[model samples]
Target: MKINWGHLNHDSAVAVQSVLETEYNFRTTVTKLFLQKLTDEMHDHLEDVQFDICPLTKCFKISPATPEPVHAALKEIMSHHLPKYKEYTYQA
Candidate 1:
């Protein structure tokens, strides 16, 4: 998934980065710089960016131009981590 870790605290972001890399099989590193930029630019496009108190990253930005593999990865994440959350979304 194309996770943006900027909204989270430094340590939490690092933990998320580790999980995405090690457990989720993502090879690329998720750096603070990358996330900082994402936090800034992402808001320009998306209307709703939700944050939870779960100590993980606050937001999940699924780009309209999101690639196939990333989309698949997000699907896997939602299935495993967000089963209780609603699947349907409405754009305003």
Candidate 2:
């Protein structure tokens, strides 16, 4: 799965990548071509974003504290990148 890290800085991107790779067993390829086209279309308003993936359940959770715009952007990105999975949002 390809993660949209355009809005994230180096450390944040690496952290996310580590979780996806180690926990979810996702193999990612980072190329110069991919980096060149990175889009910060979400405006980088969000500072801290979290993702929890459950491969068995085929669902992933995004941090509830996230702003609506960033949340929507994340949902869209996750949906596009992980079409087979479902989003698990906190209901409170």
Candidate 3:
């Protein structure tokens, strides 16, 4: 899945990506917990999945090889942190 956060400035897009990556590591609370949930539930399917940010396009891309369930889980997880960009998300 690709989520175009083109509406955000370069710095803001980077910040959001940083937050997600950081949260995934720490697993503190809220976003962290959700990210952990996705990691735990989709471990198998997520092996080849990648999360990348394109500063030029201001887009966040998830590997297309990810299973549909993983995609849905990602959408739900991202929606919490990026509600404003929901409309910009779509399958790649």
lDDT per model, in order? Answer: 0.38, 0.46, 0.51
How do the residues 7-70 of candidate 2 rate in per-residue lDDT, one tens digit apiece?
2233576666654564444323212222333356644553444544443332446655566766
Q: Is candidate 2 or candidate 3 better by TM-score?
A: 3
Q: Would you list the clashing residue pairs of candidate 2? A: none
* Candidate 3 local lDDT, residue 18: 69
* Model 1 residue 77 CA deviation in Å: 1.3
Order the numbered candidates by TM-score, best leading.
Answer: 3, 2, 1
- Tens digits of per-residue lDDT for model 3, 43-87: 666454445444444345454555688767776776676664355
lDDT of 1 by residue, 1-92 (tens): 23333433556767766645542322132232223434454434323322122224223334444544444544455555555422423221
| Model number with the top lDDT | 3
Model 1 error, position 1 (Å): 9.2
